[model samples]
Target: MIHETERTAAAYAAVLTTCGDRASAKALARALVERQLAACVQMLPIDSIYTWDGKIEEAAEILLICKIKRADYEAVEKAIRALHAYATPEIVMLPIAQGFGPYLAWIDSVTR
Candidate 1:
């Protein structure tokens, strides 16, 4: 059980990652949710332009936004590294400051 004042101690987190295609995104999303490392994963088609290997590059990718318990962050990252095709898959974690009470509870309940 979580204490009232300590809600932040068991806070929610949003993970950002990009995959080269939808297939990989789908597989990664399924694995995280199935393993209970994340409550939900939202995949979006996006166009990204950035520098890689000292050169500018542009590509289309699937962005995976995962809502999960902060406690499960490490496991989530590890799972991504294992399945991600990119030698350097982006895995960025951000704290969710506040959200609806029930929705936050659902996130905590679904993820370990």
Candidate 2:
């Protein structure tokens, strides 16, 4: 039987990342979902301000929110790194503690 933690309400996680542009964001999202690494991906345009090379920089970016299963995290991370344009892409996973039952069931069914 799957452990309590492992089976907890059907694992769900969101990977957050910023891409250089909409094209890149779309490409990454398609790749992840096509590969079954993510059940769904949502992209949004946003402004980013950060320090790089000891200089403050501001630029427009695309934020990608990926819905994936916890079991596929390693593969997802590897795939994202392989496809990501950034040398160190911001790939963060946030667990879903609670969600709509039907949606959660769909997520579990779609991913491995």
lDDT scores in order: 0.89, 0.86
Q: Give lDDT: candidate 1, residue 98.
A: 62
Identify the candidate with maximal TM-score: 1
Where in model 2 is the C-alpha error above 4 Å?
1-10
1-111 per-residue lDDT for model 2 (tens digits): 654444544577888988999999999999998888888999999999999889999999999999898788899899999999999899998887667667766777777
TM per candidate comes to 0.91, 0.89
lDDT score, residue 103, model 2?
Answer: 76
RMSD over all Cα atoms, model 2: 2.7
Worst ten-residue run, lDDT, model 2? 1-10
What is the per-residue lDDT of model 1 for residues 16-107, given as tens digits with 9 covering 90 to 100? Answer: 99999999899999999999998999999999999999999999999999998887888889999999999999999998866777888788
State residue 96's C-alpha deviation in candidate 2, in Å.
Answer: 0.9
Give Cα distance to truth, residue 85, candidate 1, Å.
0.4
